[model samples]
Target: MKKIFIISVLSLMLAVSVFSASKKKYGKEITVKETTKISEIIANPEKFEGKRVLVKGPIVDVCKERGCWIKIGSDKEFESIRFKVEDGVIVFPLDIKGMTAAAEGIVSVKKYSVEELIKSGEEHAKKEGTTFDASTVKEPKIVLQIKGEGARVDGK
Candidate 1:
């Protein structure tokens, strides 16, 4: 009876560990200890430029082609930040869109000319299977993004 009970306990523990290992880790391991809010980052991105930051949010969008990037939504409605990793370096799953993601990376600030913006917008639209209206882009735009180093995405 004692042997049987011990075996059962070990089996239960193993099963639990296996079942709970749902989070998918990608790229390098997360090293940042403090998490910056996505809204704060979006509101004052220049302050965090070239700095390493950790952030958490719902996976609002993912790169449709190679999963090279994910748009993590801020707590505030209509706000989100994109975490972009090198192509084929860390391909996030498209099915994880509704899940939560904790990502770490350096904040990048860049200015794109109107022509560059239009080109990128068109490319993005093609990737998203949507239409791009270049007329909406009237001037150069400065965008903030995270050049992702690593991420941990929770499964739904």
Candidate 2:
């Protein structure tokens, strides 16, 4: 009887583990075999720009409205990279923040002047239903982001 009870407990644990490890896929299937470090991409974005890369990280932020983008944590502390998908193509769940995700996409780099940054910031803030403080703008900024094509987010 004790052996049977032990086996039952182990079976139940295995079942739960399998169930919780479910994955939710979005967009096309990821074809990239190599994974790139987020830190490396951010540090030298020019080299990676327009190249397809696969990156894995924790989901740090997501678009609250259209779910068109997600910011994933970088290998470096306090750094993250945004993966943006076409609106209505791949919609990430707002609640997916904090979950682990693997995404594949091409890197994109853009330079913005202070004025342009302020305008874009204000527009983004308005879309997010938040207020923007344009006075914070002090310098030109270069943005590196991913044009996401596919992703797989852990269910749990």
Name the candidate that leads on lDDT: 2
lDDT of 1 by residue, 25-56 (tens): 88899998989998888889789999999999
TM agreement with the true structure for every prediction: 0.81, 0.80
Q: What digit string (tens of lDDT, one per residue) describes model 2 on residues 73-124?
A: 9989989999999999999989899998899999999999999999999998
lDDT of each: 0.92, 0.93
Give the runs in model 1 whose Cα sits over 4 Å from its true position. 1-23
The regions of model 2 sitting more than 4 angstroms off are: 1-23, 127-131
Q: How far does residue 48 in candidate 2 sit from its true spot (Å)? A: 0.3
Q: In candidate 1, where is summed lDDT lowest over 10 consecutive residues?
A: 17-26
Deviation (Å) of 24 in candidate 2: 0.2
